[model samples]
Target: MDEDRIMESERHQIEQIRELDLEELQVEEVENLHGSSDDDTSGRAYRDEFTFDAGLASLHTYLGEVEDTHHRLSFLDSGAILNLPLFYLEGVVLFPEATLPLRVIQPNLIRSVERAMSLVDVPYTIGVVRIYRDSFDGRLRFASVGTTAEIRQYRRLEDGSMNVVTRGLQRFRVRRRWIDVDGAPCGEIQIIQEDLPLRIPRDAFGTLPPLTSVSSPGPSHPTMSNTSHIKRQKCREGKNDFDADSEDSFESELSLKEMRLHQSAVESCYGCDTIDESTSSDDEKNVFESGGSQDSVTVGRSSQSNYQRNTSDALGVGRKAISQQSSHKQEKTRMDWIIMRQTRSHGVPRAFWPFWVYRMHDSYCLARKAADMWKTIVRAPSMDGFTRKPDILSFYIASKIPVSESTRQELLEIDGISYRLRREIELLENFDRVRCKNCQTVIARRSDMLVMSSEGPLGAYVNPYGYVHEIMTLYKANGLALIGHPVDEYSWFPGYAWTIANCATCERQMGWLFTATNKKLKPKYFWGIRCSQVADDMR
Candidate 1:
């Protein structure tokens, strides 16, 4: 009886996610600070995913065949400054290469879309900036750092609203913002030239023995012929073909002092680790501490990982090469590390590094590491294809990583690709739990997450009041209280009826519960937790 009771409780607790519902669920009534009780108005303001018109998807129709320095199509070919229609969304923090879908209903925004589409010289480009309310003051503030979105497709609705699909192109700094005469949000923005991916040259990096041999493509490890090198990893043993933990072999080869220097260098660049404990804010300290080991695959500890083994083997990096480093170096340190070269470079470009010093913080290494970690965390499409394009890989990971908006915003504001990739690697290493932002109550484990949309585990969707809400789907959650009765009205997930969900401890609205509206739907119920209200938590 007790066992049966426990199983029933687990099911009710949402510990198990039912099978996926492949059908599209159009829901509008998202309860938020912006939700309204008006039925007619709700239909226009809030919307869900819809099929896009294939004819309108061609970029050549709206834009000339102009290319930016990065090889991406852009309206501005030569100038650093671009005047674009700006969107200050409540919860959207777009990163480069990410896709943002919007249901435009407001007259001002609709006009802005039309204007962008109609322009001949620099058409279909809009600045997507994040606007958030201050917790202390409740005032709306716009982020200075934003991404330029290029409209890819659009369809006009009968009610005069438009469904738009936009892909982020570049990160820019807002120089000026104003409501145009047409009432659209417009900004004069300075395009921030992104730092190209940098890595320690192969000659400079020759001192270290290879861990995995599959070379990585890109500028990271250039050969004499300028051919790309392959890179792979060993994520410990299991599932995959390789069983060697190459990280173990790689770390043991480096001199103790060299490893320490590398660790310190990585910490300083990643932030908070080099932070003065006495002066650092509580939030900063908490973030660093949470990054500590919560599970076997920890940030600092050397644990059995199938990821490292598989990656190392594929790279053609042999265990023999890794074991040979001890012959050159005298001291063996207790610590195990995988990256960085020097403790300090004093703002010098990586390209200027003297050849004698070993280069460990190669952007490619970080990118490959991050991609491998991403694979281990979620069952998504492979990130191996991105390991070569470290810059895009960094942004792609930043866009889809299952964390809070504020964390994603921080990624958008970061300057260099290596720096951004390092930060993402750390976040993935420490990402484990979801907690209430206000009261810090544990809500769910990372393993409990579900991907309801192709965008990823977390996605931005609009509410009835034209506010974008970034919500993450989960099979089960704890310390949550369901508010109001379940209602299918304007449901976001078509087969699921949503019920308001709040943190039981603080009574703060966390997100919602979506119960399968149809009995045949695999997952009888699921939970949608607002990413804004959840925090990256420690175990």
Candidate 2:
């Protein structure tokens, strides 16, 4: 009986939707059609971990494959060019490691899917790109960089449409595009090279004492986690303890002037010479005197290039000349032996890459950086060290981070693992800088924002009659005033009443504020700001 009632209600709602034009339907009409004037939309906000984790795991597994596996399973060869079916989406950008759920209802889109499925070898692969609509002439423009979508699962509907789930496998740049006879857009594509983590050269700047020898310290830097700082220190100290016994006789002969020059060179390389004397620690001085302690180098994202450049220059006249050539050669040989043994022990193919490359791949370091990036995406108050493979972490951030489409697209185009991680770190660190669009006034920081939707801080929620509304949620705003009385009827969030919030200075409708009708609700009040209203370009 209950099922029958639900069916009847749904049938009635559909009839109402058909009678009233979708564009013309008012908010009251929508509520009446769905019989949801008393409905609380808040229940849908809570996320289930099982679904999220399963999806994440699938993506991780797909992207975590080795280079050879990716090659064997690839749908297209590197140089081979072919026209493939294209699907253009709005307000969405797909990354190579993400999965996109699509509904194919239009005749052209359905035909495109059918054509792709008819292929013998790789029946599921198709080209997916973003379409940007112009504000002036209202013309659609396709993005140059697009991803190849591999249809993982699909179901045909009675209406000849299909529901499909696809994973993004590789990035391709469009060479040319044309409409096919069936009205489906097809594109000739060139595959973009996959970005992998690079090996740090043992002598990155040839003959330069690695930055690890430098000693000048205080509190840990923001770019690296505290745990990494401690681990790096402990590892360096352990190595130094062994070297101390061997170097004791040689250390006694070194002049104080040479030691001072080495320390100065390290300081210059780290851009730490500007530090005040009062802030320098006695512990730091002791470490520098020991000549074995590795203390100063904390190469964060922004300073990686700088550290490389300065270290090359610092090598000049800093203990290298005075150190016996035979002793240096022995040390280099020992390092080579250790690297070779590691390569052989791992059974990594010698043909795959050079020994030094594998050493610099440094899985442990890359994993730590990936963990930090994950913490940023989830908006954790502090770093939560969840180790993930670097490639998986890159795709996770690219797919999950709640930034503007343009920012996400920029991340998609970036090619190196280290560079991509750095870019994500920069974006996450700067997520809060929100300003007004028209007058260039400071509005609200990301810290003050509260995400009330599953989609994220910014989300698109469609009404019962299929009207799409893009909404951004925030906790506070600087120059906005509320208009009209709070309405409890048909509130999106349960047990809350909403009032119109408009810019106090410009008087434009910014968004709304939802306050709990039930005093016991956890979030007493929250704001939903429109992305179109706020200025994201701080510059």
Q: Clashing pairs in model 2? A: none
Model 2 residue runs over 4 Å out of place are 1-80, 134-138, 201-377, 380-388, 434-444, 448-539
User: What would the per-residue lDDT of candidate 2 be over residues 376-421, giving only the tens digit for each residue?
Assistant: 4444334333333566566656665555566667778777666676
lDDT of 1 by residue, 66-134 (tens): 233232354443238868888888667898877776768889999998887766656777889998777
Alpha-carbon TM-score of each model against the true structure: 0.58, 0.52
In angstroms, how far off is 497's CA in candidate 1?
2.6
State residue 283's C-alpha deviation in candidate 1, in Å.
37
Each prediction's whole-model lDDT (CA): 0.60, 0.52
| Predicted model with the maximum TM-score | 1
